[model samples]
Target: MASSSSSSSLKFTVRRCQPQLVPPAIPTPREVKPLSDIDDQEALRTHLPVIQIYRKQASMAEKDPVQVIRQALSQTLVFYYPFAGRLREGPHRKLMVDCTGEGVMFIEADADVTLDQFGDSLQPPFPCFHELLYDVPGTQEITNAPLLLVQVTRLKCGGFILAIRLNHTMCDGPGFKQFMSAWAEMARGATKPSIAPVWRRELLMARDPPRITCNHREFEQVQDTLPSSDQNLVQRSFFFGPLDIAALRRLIPQHLQHCTTFDLITACLWRCRTKALQIEADEDVRMMCIVNGRGRFNPPLPVGYYGNAFAYPAAVTTAGKLCRNPFGYAVELINKVKGEMTEEYLQSVADLMVMKGRCLFTTARSYMVSHLARLNLKEVDFGWGDAVYGGGAKAGAGRFLGVSYFCSAKNGKGEEGIIFPICLPAEAMERFAQEFNLMLGNKSQPQTSSATFIMSTL
Candidate 1:
């Protein structure tokens, strides 16, 4: 009897190897199928072009800057030869172009910079993803599709700012980081990379050619219909010390019955965002959390899967109810949404991609802006030292603001907080900051009620 009991207990423990969580089933408009007659080989032959321009150091003059840049572009193309074959798809398998072809000009400004100055510096950011590709005359149709743009600005103080505008389709934060590392290696003149680029498509390929699964149909949404203007948006950086984050983590298990640190933090932000916006309970408020699908799949993603390896898993709550709920309750909602991030769900999405074929482009255009926030930026460091400050998605883009938090390695600050670029109405921005500070225990003293909120500049 004792031996039997022990055997039963061991089996039970093995079954719980990371609780089985699956995404909630959402209904899809229709079932789509891949084109039977299309040539798959021809489809995969395209490349994601890259453009870059380097500013020569002062005291060094080039008679023909354009000629010099042309040469540099040719050399960079050779350096990118290995990666040329990888970026052939639209977004996930999509290519990335180096967009520094036009000579990058330098601007001298005061030590103190304003938001407008920064914005001005990145004028006419890459219009589309294809534009980042090489400037081929007839291939202009393909190369001019500018999805990502990068600007490496040399400051008068001897520092450089590498600003990149990435199309959401290419890759999420992690994918971008991988590409950057590769680019850096090329820039440093390394014959071979410390980290070899992985481009094994078969490993990422779906089980069989027509692997049609019902789950794939539900998550498909058109991306282009997303709102384009977020002019009223505002961005602010917040710091949560190690002790504070640890305290929150400890309190989480007690408050939210079942959840992780990521869920709790997201819930806290979602609640605060709705409260500050004065959104009503009946209206749906969503928090889109990005899930990295690299190692999550069953067979696992290839090392060189450079395309978009991130998916948006969303949780929604009404404004009134969210504000009234405890932080833990919100955390549970996040957990529920995260639970759905399974290998089946990711493969379902891939299967959908294969089926939709041409229609996929139209679908991507419609559902782009659904109030999503990504949390993995904290892990992005170019080795120039962990990013002291990092953020993207310029203000005035969407109703749902995206905030990315980075982990601070310096000073052992365990998972340092995020730098949020919020797109809220002007009036709501002030209140959002107040609630944000309150979460961090930085509220004003009882003696000064007026001091509870302080407005921040863009």
Candidate 2:
């Protein structure tokens, strides 16, 4: 696999206009809004980078995507005004949104290349991502920084790429999807978003007296031994089409054939990854599955509540047991942990977060997977039809080790399937590919490659 910058041979320069602050079109109240316990977690303090590429469409050829989205963003901010505010920290590192309507950073640029030049597949890690979404200095801190940073780069072919640096402290993947869809609706000239934005952070607050009703092993402190240097790791995207999935399903027991796509893929990847890492036989390895808490509420959370509303329930086992057992073993462990996510479980997590002073999620020998396949990210359009690609700009969440995202995507050949970006050491990555190929019965070629690449190490 090639690095992000080296993946593409086409060289092009981007001429950028001065970045400006775009505030809400309408004035909002000057009040401070407290974030939910889940929103203020220590692990989510960094900004999440995302990208969307739009091709020139006949229907929208007459319009400028940058201008359209810029105007729409202002209008959308009226309903989702908190995005225009800056984050502030109180005593105990508690976070709050200072709703000053200060505005978000926006930039417009024109690239010399066209959409086709980016290669057949637009899935991440996208090449020249840093150029697409330049991180303006003094605007990336967790607090006292722009909540949203957007850069719209126009291509020579009239299509454009929309890149963003979103404050993870404000919302999770699903919540950000909602916000983007709403912004798209605005661009299409909707008077109001079909789903109104809601800000009831109090709903996910820790219970009174903060009781830890259930075990929260995902947050337990551990002596993390993962190497800090990214030079030892490489990022790559793997495609799982219908045939690939069917092949995996054959490994499971007949009774578990009805398992979900996420269940099957998570299990297969966990087994393959663990084997690739070659941890000690007795060492405990864990897989943390991010479960959305929206539906777990007795009465579901409001339709448009865009705060962090997810919990990571982990499945744990010894490396030897996980590797030696059949594939069904991993799936069962995943299914069991997923089943533990309930209303009570969410409350327990909130309590645990507060009790632990918002400690970071355990990273020791742990692989975290977040399923974005159901987030409806493909539906986000700024009047030029659905994007050619839209979602996380790269693999592995910002500085967090051993993180991966599963999303629905189309290949260069236009085949729709599940695509996941994995980052691992060069040696481990080669081993991972070999293990995966062995499962699929394709030993001829072990390594898988995609057009997108990660320029920066790790």
Candidate 3:
């Protein structure tokens, strides 16, 4: 129960069959394939769970989702053979796939509940999320474990929920999406995927004499300024619609009006979160922006190259400067980090990873945000059309080590917008909501001069 509130009291029992490994449809080559330096980073050696809910379609009323997906997954593994292998660690803690053709873990389940019973809002944190995709005990490790775990829970309403727990070391969000899309194509009777899978991870390998070119502030060690207690932390999702976005945009200067939606909203969240925590004004705070490097390269990585190709370029500033400064101040810091997403910067990161022994991103008084609203995960269809809800199973609550996601979702009123979840102590979460609501409701722009002193005390 990582849910934000206890109001989600709806409960149901699910009957699950024995878990089994589904190997590739045909025998594949057996060899050792090393992962890119970026892929073996300690920060990515964990599993990430994603859920997609599909409603029953009248045209495919008699089709069995479990069987279709099971068959499709086996066919998919033949091409994406790395997923059918197990991760192995070598000297200096480097990771590589053993190409064992051992296959992935799959489970079939039937839940005594309908899609509508989950409530009007299909957003996370979903009730009984863990049951939707059980960890299966020893399968949670990074090395010598199934690269992917999938559970297809058929609902009483003829709809089925597709839950997948993928090892982050294998691929990123976009990479995972590409794999799923190909699997869906197979389920739809495609003999082969439209786009072929490519394994040129060596392209992201570190240079012989690794060079640290740029300032890697994202990995800098710092002090944790907030209260040490992790208990009483609660997670909640907030919706920002067109009107809400308009109000937030009004807070920034007219010159920054053209800033992307992610820049605007993320800046606002960082400010509001800092204010709510009541952190010391002199302490430094950071906002780690996850930038995708696929398009940043000179010629770009190959299509269907499913690997970790992202970086967390951080923006650092003192709490006093951040909370008291004009709204554009935060936006400017974010833009600067995003602008640094070049081929050289990514190569520099690979060098840094190898040099630093693959350290985790700094979380000292920092908030991390990833924009997943545009991933079009909702469009993934396994013959039933779009999913009613498709994305991370849970938003906050340390599911992503305090990283919150901006997902595309429709509110209970059917208004489509961006929904993101934040985790904070109970009292801090209350204050955060108040501060955010005030900003959203205020039509006038903030006066930096007069509000500077007043904002720091918030």
TM per prediction: 0.58, 0.95, 0.93
In model 3, how large is the Cα lDDT of residue 126?
A: 58
| RMSD (CA, Å), each prediction | 17.7, 2.7, 5.9
**Which tens-of-lDDT digit does each residue in 199-289 have in candidate 2?**
9999988988999999878877778564554667677788778777888888899988878888988998998899998888888888999
Model 3 error, position 153 (Å): 0.6
Badly placed stretches (over 4 Å) of model 3 are 1-8, 396-400, 442-458
lDDT of 1 by residue, 1-458 (tens): 00110111111000101111111122212211111111121222222222222233443342233222223323333322322211223343333333223221111111122222232122111221121122223322323333333333333333334444443443445555565555455444444445555534344344566465534222445233334334554343333445545555664556454465566556656776677767555655666555677778767776655555544555655666777865666778777776666766655555655556522222211112222224333233332332333444232221223444332222222344332334455566578778866765663211111111122332
Whole-model alpha-carbon lDDT for candidate 3: 0.82
User: Comparing candidate 2 with candidate 3, which one achieves the higher lDDT?
Assistant: 2
Q: Each model's C-alpha lDDT? A: 0.40, 0.84, 0.82
lDDT of 1 at 184: 50
lDDT (10s digit) by residue, model 3, range 1-458: 21121233466777788889999999999999999988988778878778899999999898999999999999999999999999999988889999999999999998888888777436665546667887687898899999999999999999999999989999988888889999999999999988898889899999999999999888899877566655566656777888889887877898887788999889989999999999899998989888999998879999989999998888999999999898899998887788888889889989988998988778788888888787878999889999987887654322334677887888756778887767677688778888888878853222111111111111
| Model 1: per-residue Cα lDDT at residue 229 | 35
